[model samples]
Target: MSGRTRLRGRFQLFATLLVTLVQLPTVLWLCWLTRTPLPLAVAVPVSFPYLRQLQSPWHTTAPALSTYLALGWWAACAVFDVLMLPAALAVQAGLPRGVTWGVAGAIALVLGTDSVLGRPRLRKRVVHVEGLSPELDGYRIGQLSDVHCGPHAPESRVSSWVARLNALDLDLVTVTGDLITHGSSHVEAVARALGGLRAKDGAFACMGNHDYFTDGEHLVRELERQGVTVLRNRGVVVQRGGARLYVAGVDDTWTSRHDVARALAKRPEGVPTVLLAHDPDLFPEAQARSVELTLSGHTHGGQLGVPGVRRLSLARFVSRWTAGLYRQGRSWLYVNRGAGTTGPPARLGAPAELAVITLRRA
Candidate 1:
């Protein structure tokens, strides 16, 4: 290898070692302090395995583990900072100490504030797309994805999301993926909530990875019952004002099979085709199929980002187009940050967003 290449390799190795050192100790310390025997045992065996995966030459798995480690450490630190504040404050008062307690207190305060803050501020991104075929300009498409409607997102939040989308006066509203968390019981309720959305074209959706974890078939049937077209590897041609647009959907990569060729088989020639794939990784396939635009959302813009640095390393491996608009050769990919929160329901720098894309002829 060249000298520069060797230097880069060495720097990567050093970074890996530093990350392992930080993560192993934090995990062990948290396990010890929390008296969580299960986590300790789990952490011990998985530590080397995880580190090995992190150090792997393959970019795919390594970045994913790195992201998991970073997020895990941040979450653990936040928890400890919250739980140990009183004792740390007392210790600080008893002796002259530095501002570690104060720093921890600040993190705890932010965590608490986020917990009670419900949803992050929603922003409408109006993207004007030119070069649309047949003067198919001024077409509005509303996007909502990653609605993990369970404990963190109740029916009320789902209702709010539906209401917001309904008020957008969109030509069509499309939910890319991640409709519900788990269980078939919540599927109907989620569908009912989302059914309130209104658009002249229609509301369509595809299965996400989470949907398969739950009952995918049941969820699809439930959503279809609620007037939303559950497009599983399917395509539909929509015509308006002397112009036609082809809209297609594919299943999640991790779950149910995705057949891009099948989805695009019957699409009309030269019509602007838009695809909805749950994961952004499908962009390459969409581009190969000559798709004009694609919409997706599964990363949630890392859900918790620190400014200036890429938050989710997993997303980087999957797609450079993690959030916002990206060009893949001639095709365009837009990944929404997401409409709702999952798990802890805390968003730091990355706020939830609803994308309103308007297409026009170039």
Candidate 2:
């Protein structure tokens, strides 16, 4: 095997081991609490879905009922462990087990409900640009990102989101990567869903790291066939009335295909530029290049966070550009919370997001 492939395998193995290890304590605790067999409890969570997936290829079109049940159980246990681990520690520190369990369970119940049942809503924001043209003023752009359309986010959910975006009558729609997760089997479904997006200016997208995981090139072609332009280190000019707005996109950063300078090459000198980058970390490069607005969605708004406290989100551990609008000088960055969940298929304070951004001349 190639070095990269071997490294990826190792990484996946490491991650799986780490997750299993983390769940072990909770598994033991639960077994003890409920007087269940420790071996069976551990085996049940550690195997099932994963083993099933390994033993038999996933039927993406219609997942097995047992697989669904296994996934649901595993997800619940993972969330439960995360919620209860601290409480477990507190109990070790001489706190009453009953009180700790009560408090943690209550918190878990509230957050778990939000995570599993919450949906993305249209979030409206107005951005004032210093030198935006009158013709491009009040421009309505719909941003969708990290829509991991697979078992977690089925085609129905994706289609529903597309319908909502179309209903807004947006001037333009931008998807900032991660159209699919799990595998490439659902690429066509996601492409078809995205194809339904209607905007005066049309829909455009940039690749995310996950897309690369599932044949990025193939996904790009499929998106193109569906009438969605997948911009890869390229820029396009959209003329509205008498003014021109430059829209550029770069490849995902994770795959080392991001080239900000290349994406902006040969741009019209005086027109204001907006960059569609999958990772928000590119804001610095785009901002330095004087791009007026940079749209991104990779962090998933920290996916799990406190309702009022932005910094407390789980995404904070990895990215500074968690969600919402950020500005430095004349450059603006807006990170959408994303349309679907990834690994855990859940959301808390940071519900899935569909950004309705209106650009105004300052």
* Candidate that would win on TM-score: 2
- Backbone clashes in model 2, listed as residue pairs: 115-347
Off by over 4 Å in 2: 1-111
* Candidate 2 TM-score, C-alpha based: 0.75
Output the worst ten-in-a-row residue range by lDDT, candidate 1: 55-64
lDDT of each: 0.71, 0.81
True-structure RMSD, every candidate: 11.1, 5.2
Which runs in model 1 stand beyond 4 Å of their true positions?
Answer: 1-112, 115-120, 126-130, 133-135, 308-314, 317-319
TM-scores of all candidate predictions against the true structure = 0.68, 0.75
lDDT of each residue in 106-173, candidate 1, tens digit only: 66546535533536444554444445755467788888888877755677888898888788788999
Colliding residue pairs in candidate 1: 131-362
For model 1 the TM-score comes to 0.68
